[model samples]
Target: MEASPARRPHRLDPAGGCPHAVNARLLARGAVTPVELPGGIEGMAVLGHAALKEFLQHPEVAKNQRHFTALREGRIAAGWPLLTFATVQGMTTADGDDHRRLRSLAGRAFTPRRVEELRPRIERLVAELLDGLERAAEAGGGVADLRRHLALPLPMSVISELLGVDVEFRDRLHHLSSVVVATDTGPADAVAANRELVAVLGEIVAAKAARPGGDLTSALIAARDEGGDRLSHQELIGTLLLMIVAGHETTLNLITNAVRALCAHPGQLDLVRAGRASWADVVEETLRWDSPVSYFPFRYPVRDITVDGTLIPAGTPVLAGYSAAGRDPAAHGADAGRFDVTRPARPGSVRHLSLGHGTHYCLGAPLARLEATVALERLFTRFPGLGLGVPEAGLTPHAGFVGNSVHALPVLLRR
Candidate 1:
């Protein structure tokens, strides 16, 4: 009688196209399908495992998302920058040699040793957060917002410490980032938030410049200084903004989404409760079942490219629907939509492109994995009685296609 986690709110609509659901039906019929977006813009949607995987690795598919040709030709309005394009000058937006250079510089912060060194600290943060959650539950008469107390704060604290961002400034950054990412935020508010965010990041950069500390921000400042015009001033600011926004938000989604998935699936939850499955299994399954990032925006093609039979014209914008890719039955078997922690590991298992594939892959992949693994393992192990406080349908979804997350995850921390 109860809803399954895989069948949670927003997973599908009456017409059967969930907010970010790929056209599985169309994919079955063909490799590429034509579709229209919100603004009457025509584009091509790549469906199924092979087409999507090939799309991701295709050289003709440009990562340069400026949509410069469209901007110049006036296809779409050059109005206030959307949340997905907020860091246009950052590494995510660069191409060719510029992309390689920026990625290399930022890659230093997430080396294997660096991520390994963060384990103990992350575990301590998780334990401390659990203690706070227990207290909050006691104070709330046995109910607490797990997302607010644990999911959101753990990554926020970790990222701030890593970047040397003063504790006082984090609340403001969180507020701004949320507004920027949400789709429902009005143009006026988005513009205002964007301005404030730019000003705040500018101040943080100046502070780091005056006295370079041993943080990532300081190291980036040194990188720019030593390069002698290699990294522009805008590039420096963009890189820092990229780190702050991408670093915490994605991990927050990962942690929160994993918890939600477990609470909705009792059989799978029981497996973990009985030690039949590890937390790593839960994390990977969640990433595949319901990706933290619903849809990665704006990958264009440099020239006309055909997938299956559909021809995606040159300079047209295409969205890599990893949210859809995760559920491709061709890639993960007929029951790909089902959530099962006991799914057997294969020699060459299908990889979920949630964190992305290719050169533009997430730089924070190792760090995000470390945080999620430690946080989830510690949370469940500490409070074996954790369960949802609210009904599955009552959870509020984030008002955007970019982030596949709910606004909050309320739970009974102990019962």
Candidate 2:
């Protein structure tokens, strides 16, 4: 008889600790027990580089789910919509062959070449935003909320341009995206928002179809019409929704986190300001120090499997803590938690699960990097004496999900 196929590992009780707690210990000991969720069978199995590499590259694991019953029910109780526009039309929930096809189509528009071509435009947007920030500081006695003025709008503006959506409508769309992501909102509210967004997207799609332009929306419409790769109405709508939400929300967090990290670490900030250190390193370290997308939800074993000697049954829900992995001492040594931009690059120098791994790796990784790098460079260059106007403790952290964001990042643009 042929040998049996290898089984995926599982961990029972999996370090009965919150992801942050587990990460603290991991940063000290180089490894720890896998972290489980409030409900058993749903938690991240904290692993070192070796295990993480295996887990991320594993073919058996899948991130797509038809509906997040637990998350949905939670949202319903909070009074949000059952299926927000994003849940109904986003591509992250797609799996297997359908996922592959959709990703391939979107990949064309997200290519490195396309993103590079948009660099000058992104820089221009940054310059415009900074000008507003400068005005806000001068008007507000040298202090302004960077989150409101820069971090939030920068990505939203870029995404709007990419999707061919009206930037003037960002506030409305941002409200819908918030409802879609907020667990505090009840299902009904979320459902309503989803419906409204879908309707809006439908109109945009129809308009683009009739008068195609040179935007991603037009590209998608063209593919559906002239190209052989015809996309269903739902796919087109969902893909567009995903692009708007994922493209902006995640990038927003990234910019906010980078700014916050630098403020908290003055030495690092000085390095960035002086131009003595590469902005690339600063960005990478910031990403590892406090990754924007904290934990991502993924499905558990498809069959009974053992992970590091623990057995987990099939159909379980698990969340992998990418933030926890980035701070793991085993991977980054004793100073894993330190924000050091001058740290030399090693074999795994810039390794962090921030962009995720395996088949679910973020496709917007390059663009996000470009946006952050350009935005930071422009901001610091324009406002060399930029400093937090509010007390660090006064900053309000964004609740829910793995996003490390503060509601307002007040900075004094005194150059």
Candidate 3:
């Protein structure tokens, strides 16, 4: 007797599933179908044009819920505070008035003018990192881990200064950020790491409150003191932590991923090196090709909603695969997977979802772009023949909810 189709195991293992799995499954069925997710998390109903639009902006979808609960536990991670409190402070947890308020306040601190003022400092930081990378290359006989000397430290230093976290404690904070963001980790471990982060942030906030230094933290404290739209202590801590982690981790991946992409695609790297393409193009293409974030895992449904005519019950978790969305052919065309630095930006281009969109656009986009452009430009310029010391497959991608980074990127600087 033939085995029933329903009882047969899926040919595509969900564990090693890539973003294209949804597309392939959709093509096979001649329609979008919900493929079962491992461990009972609701399967992603392959989204097309209408489905993608509605699901992303759906009122009932809450982005902060424990979407990975079955893989770990029902307990939410402490990092949840960053999204939840921001919802209270007016960030984009829901589709309503609160998002407007939070976005307005965050906008003030993250304006284009503020980013412009930060340009010179960012340039200096990039130069300093390059200088250090040069020294490390010389010491290691012309090869060094760029991830350590350049990719990781550059952003960590910038964010520490911006958020008023002690530069001396950055190493500890980095570890805490890593543990808190790991998806495979249990809730208890995540909570403990988050508590440690809160304590560290608490100290920084108190110091800033006392001194009111020339940093974003101090500015926030002043906003609080003036009273009209002051931030509460919890809000202050939550926002500060969010900015610090968001700023450092995402930019770190941006630099590391760009370097890796360039090295792997030497033709593209040569274009960047020859000045045929600007660092901005390199940054944009890198973001589209290997997005810093694999997924944005929080979205709560405000009401029962239908996506592509498939009903997702109210409050059900919806995970937007930014990496998936960026490569969706319906959005970017059949050649969406190709990395073309020269691809002109169209009015409605969706080639990159690195900065997110709709109500919860990234707050530090300008600063991140500034840092990446400067860092990559100087990096390639300083070491004209730089190439990865290890093979592409040897690099370990970071396993986490928020970032896609290599464990270390060792490169030979052939100056």
Index of the highest-TM-score prediction: 1
Give candidate 1 misplaced runs (Cα > 4 Å): 1-31, 66-68, 78-87, 227-229, 345-349
In model 3, the runs with Cα more than 4 Å from the true position are: 1-54, 59-95, 226-229, 273-275
Give each model a TM-score: 0.90, 0.84, 0.84
Q: In model 1, state the lDDT of residue 99.
A: 87
Candidate 1 vs candidate 3: the TM-score winner is 1
Which predicted model would earn the best lDDT? 1
Q: What's each prediction's clash count?
A: 0, 20, 16
Residue 302 error, candidate 1, Å:
0.3
State in Å the error of residue 103, model 1. 0.8
* lDDT for each residue of candidate 3 in 139-232, tens digit (9 for 90 to 100): 9988899999988888899888877778777998898887765555455675678779889888887877788877778887777677764456
lDDT string for model 2 (184-262, tens) is: 4445675687778788888888878788788889888776766554577777988888788788888888888888888
Preferred candidate (lDDT higher): 2 or 3: 2
Segments in model 2 whose C-alpha atoms lie over 4 Å from true places: 1-52, 66-90, 225-230, 273-276, 348-350
